[model samples]
Target chain A: MDWKRYLFIALIIIALFSVVIFVGKTQTPPLVIAMSMLATTLMVATPLTLGALSGVFCETSAVINIGIEGMMLAAAFFGWLAAIYMNTIFGYEPMPSLITGVVVAVLTGGIFGLLLAVLSITFKVDQIIGGTVVNMLAIGITGFLNRQLFFEKNSVFGGQVPHAPGTLPIIHLPVPKVVGGVCSLFTADGCPTFANALGKVFDQRPIAILAIVLVFVSHYVIFHTRWGLRTRAVGEHPRAADTVGINVTRVRYINVVIGGLLAGLGGAYFTLESVPSFEPLMTNGRGFIALAAMIFGNWTPIGSWAAALVFGAAQAMQINLQFFRDLIPPAWSFLQQSYIVGLTPYLLTMLILTGIVGKTVPPAADGQPYEK
Target chain B: MSENKRSFQDALSESPLVVPILAIFTSMVLGGIIIAWAGGNPVAAYIGLYQGAFGSLNALSETAVWATPYILAGLAVAFAFKGGLFNIGAEGQLALGAVAAAWVGYALPDLLGAELPRYLHLTLALGAGTLAGLIWGAIPGWLKAHTGGHEVINTIMMNYIALNMTSFLLNGVMKDPSPTNVIARTPLIAETARLGTLFAKYRVHWGFIMALVAAAIVWWLLERTTFGFEIRTVGANPDAAQYAGINVKRIITWTMAISGLLAGLAGAVEVTGLNYRHELGFSVGYGFDAIAIALLGKTHPLGVVLAALLFAAMRNGGTRMQFMTQIPVDIISVIQALILLFVAADAIIRYIYRLKASEDKLVLTRGWGG
Candidate 1:
């Protein structure tokens, strides 16, 4: 179907929101709520987009990377730790320390990616189980370290991570803000109506903006570039690519390593950009959901980011369903429940997976171990 | 069925047990090193772990209790793997089973306005749980069989739905009614639905025996029966099996349903035999852990039993290891992950042991669009 048909996310969003509306109605203006939700979903979509982009890079090179979750998680903890350590030691500069943290997170993810590449590609382990091992390591190490550093406050964990949030910066998107301010001028909320929401949508953290830009960059790289052609060739038919003098193993390894960098950037979103502190399991299964996004997007960068936006909207709706419960008729309001609200993204994932809206095939050699 | 099958004498020297045992031993040694690095005396920690798993009647009982779930869950994964499928949805199936069993146990009698007989009530509860799992598992199987959907992705998505749905039921309609109860759990089952403990002093119950019998049944089905032969054949090669006139699609669906039935039984046992109620957080990761157990056991029924027991011991011992050394119990997961890593990527093991590679390899799953 040329795969671009997978971009039919409009129906998915409407279906999901209809269910939400069916459960209950909200007192807030639905349009305003939706606009705000659109803004927030993009914010939430950033990390997932990056994670899916990472998956695209790896999977498109014929390597299955279920370890994106673990990579992001490891990056999340270490990134937060690096930033905290720097802020405490290097004169309270958020930029330098936070940058260091982001770099460390990316490095950690890359290392984990390298581990996956070696285990699955070099050693020919089952890719899924190899990824499982990385996940276990991420969880165990992060949990163990979290206890020592934050819980027990042990000196051995790491000396003195900064508790300060002000040192962190929030980068504003000047373009979105100006446009939003003009749009909001007529709204009853007195201030520019769309200004705050538009700013919220556009004024993303550096990591968030990077995630959005990378979506386009990844798309261009995968579809338009010579390197991308070779990558797709390797993923779909390793022997064919190899016959053409492309280094299959090397491409898989290097692409997967870069995939890790993207996932690490996603992880940094959790600690540095989203929240200023580290918590156990803060990634909260988003990595897995990102995999779903990648699949839903038919393994394309723009499609994946779009899918991420859908998931992000679901997440946004989840947070507000309770407040919007009043929108429901009183009898049905009883049905407006947490689990059902929480169920939006998962249900949507499964529905999209059924390929009713769109169908796309994966790269032929996606999960197979290639041996010369 | 095939000329490549080994003779008794050949099997004796080249036992399938060797690689798995070595994997376990290597993992233990690695775990010991990690324990030492964590600042605990490795020998003492091992001693404590041993004591925790088998040092006393109480510890042994606890190990058996833990093994009850592991055995069934491992069997589910192993059974699926042998059928050329990866049953990642065991977690969801188990949850559905637990919740269904709990509903049947607690709500059925009240709905009927009479206390059902023990055998009937227990049977119904167990059957309901099994049925829920079968139905749940069958969806993905049917999807895979009919529409070329991958069970791996479908199963994971199922887990999310099952878990969230379960959470809702527990918190809302099914909540325990006790005044002090703030936990998300169901009311205790009717007395008739509960499984009796083997004896007064031990926590182990009839479920442990049931687990053993389940293992034996799985072994017999896979090794002795025609259906088992067909499943294995289809798993080995669907096209070849089809050419041989075997119904591959039906086998896949039935295989998944039965695998899910076994996993659901694990959840049923937990409710009727041990917990007596379904709690929101209980049995959270047992299904995922079963993947490691299945691989560790080499996907053989007997292997599954032994592997489940070993995993149970580690899990049970983890408590004591933590109490003594204050090392986080997550180390067990670490050891498990390491074991799976070595076993999954067996080249390192082969290189270390200088063993020849076998022509026949395990097929865990053929991921996405395969």
Candidate 2:
């Protein structure tokens, strides 16, 4: 509705893009560099998109799922463990075994989500602490099980001989060369084969594609469906929803559980998709970053997708810091450390949360216990 | 619900410890089941755990050593809880404090080009560390006060920033430079800055004693002082506090600063009293453990002391438990989490134990938008 605001924002983003290109380009042909950056941004955005969607679902139903990190952790370990169990113990092929792993991961997340639901809803626990308990449980249980099942000699420390097993296969999509090829005609020398540009992005694995599809699906489901209305109603006013004959408890439980299922898929992305091996603390702080994205996006699925991509770009920028180093003069070598650039996403998150300009609205009933 | 008119003493007399005791018992029962499921005899493992925590003078002293940091961190969280704030940035605050104190301990002597007196040097080191934590904690507090930025998210973000910044600085500038030192740690503090061990061949130091005194001080401040009265009033109902002419915003900022100060003291004591140095890996989960301690202690000062000892015993004894029964030391973490779960949601404990609910229960952090 506000055309001026949209135009101004678009201009700013275009200006920022031009600045990045001007400062980053070198003798190495800018087109290839730019395409790879896009690919990496998509790569980093995959898990964050799923995590933010899960956050949106839970918060829309008035439950704050701070345990998303823990759920992802639990699902990550269990998913890999399931794969190991099926392939090594049961002697199954990778396809069936990987499916089983995905199922287990989803179920693990659902169970943890159920625990959070029971604690925060039925027992009326402090929601934040309840989520924290789930996180602690995930870490402790996974670590304890890791030692018993995987550690060599089952010793108190030192030996870490892990069991290797089968993994999921990646699905490469068709190249977007035809469209990219046309766009490159505008460039003076047709920098690189635009096919390489399109191919770089399409070479993504299965979960990455699913993340893109889920972003659209989640956006539509939240905005265009009857269930979305009930969720929002319950989040804003459970009493009013109840008066209107909606089952507030059932809606919250279903939404939160579904949220957990999405979180589990995000977790599996780490073990089954991102990398093959399951390491302790592998999920890292991505779950928290996803939370930040959710807040920054104002709890909307489409908005979260964009916010997550920005964060992903931030990380990608650091990983490909040679481009940034090219910006610095050769004489100022001391200022070109990658570590300093790695601070971007976190600092960006803090700045976003600080909201120097306007207030970001959160779900009204988030972290509150419903009283019948 | 009808007992609101009862005095505080009457309330205490009417089974104040029932929920916490029930929570502890329930968690232990759950933990026993877990241990049994893991193919170890729960009774033997617990017996071994008990022995390891208190079997000898060394075990008792080790438990005390663990409790030193736990008490300070727990009190920090507890103090914040009293003010209706969740100070999850304790981990960051602790690290900043440790690094600051280490810088003061080693660098100060060299910077002055003279050997400073023990009293002044130690105080200055600790004061600097506390000041660092105070400033770190105040930023989030200030943001929450002015911008309505949520402290929980800001604090967690600060944890990452603090940790990575500490890592970068440690590797670049403050890294131990001796041939044998490959790790990211600072050099040992000056002899004058190091705390004296309490006894021969024992690791416990004056820090343990200081922790107890600190607990007493927190108790007295919360219960006796007018400043604390204002804090409690603000925590209970900010609108009321504002109507009473109390500076609610200032109280919040001060509460967080003091909480950070306590956490900073924990780091400072750990450096001077036990390790005599700061490392990137030292005191990793003490801040998280402190939350459980604070909750398990019913957010009371003395209760925190006892709860810290309990947690410390479990942590200190975990190694022996693992050594004897081959159980993972993470069981302690599991049990601690269970305890927090039961404590945070006492309705489950009360239902299981068939205990009557008490009036005027403690409140944790407010919901979103509060």
lDDT of 2 by residue, A1-372 (tens): 134423433443334344345557764456766777778778878888888988899999989888888999999999988876676655645776777888899888888888988887887788888888888888878877787766636443234533445456756665665555575778765445776676787777777888889988988888889998889999989999999999998999988888888899888888877776787767777888898888877888877777788778777766665667667667655436665656767787787777743456877888888998
DockQ of candidates 1 onward, in order?
0.52, 0.62
User: In terms of TM-score, how similar is model 2 to the real structure?
Assistant: 0.93
lDDT at A178, model 2: 58
**Lowest-sum lDDT 10-residue window in model 2 chain B:** B5-14
**Whose DockQ is greatest here?**
2
TM-score of B-chain for each predicted structure, in order:
0.94, 0.95
Q: Report the Cα interface RMSD of each model, rounded to 1 decimal.
A: 1.9, 1.8
Q: Positional deviation of B92 in candidate 2, in angstroms? A: 1.1
Where's the lowest-lDDT run of ten residues in candidate 1 chain B? B4-13
TM-score of chain A of 2: 0.87
lDDT of 1 by residue, A1-372 (tens): 244444467766766566555444445555556565666677788788999999999999988888888899999999988887777777645788888999999999999999999998998777887887788778767876676455443335443444644324667758655675565676655355455555665656688778888998998999999999999999999998999899999999999999999999999889988888887778877888899889878888988888898998888777656666666677665446767777778777777777766567789999998878
For lDDT, the strongest prediction is 1
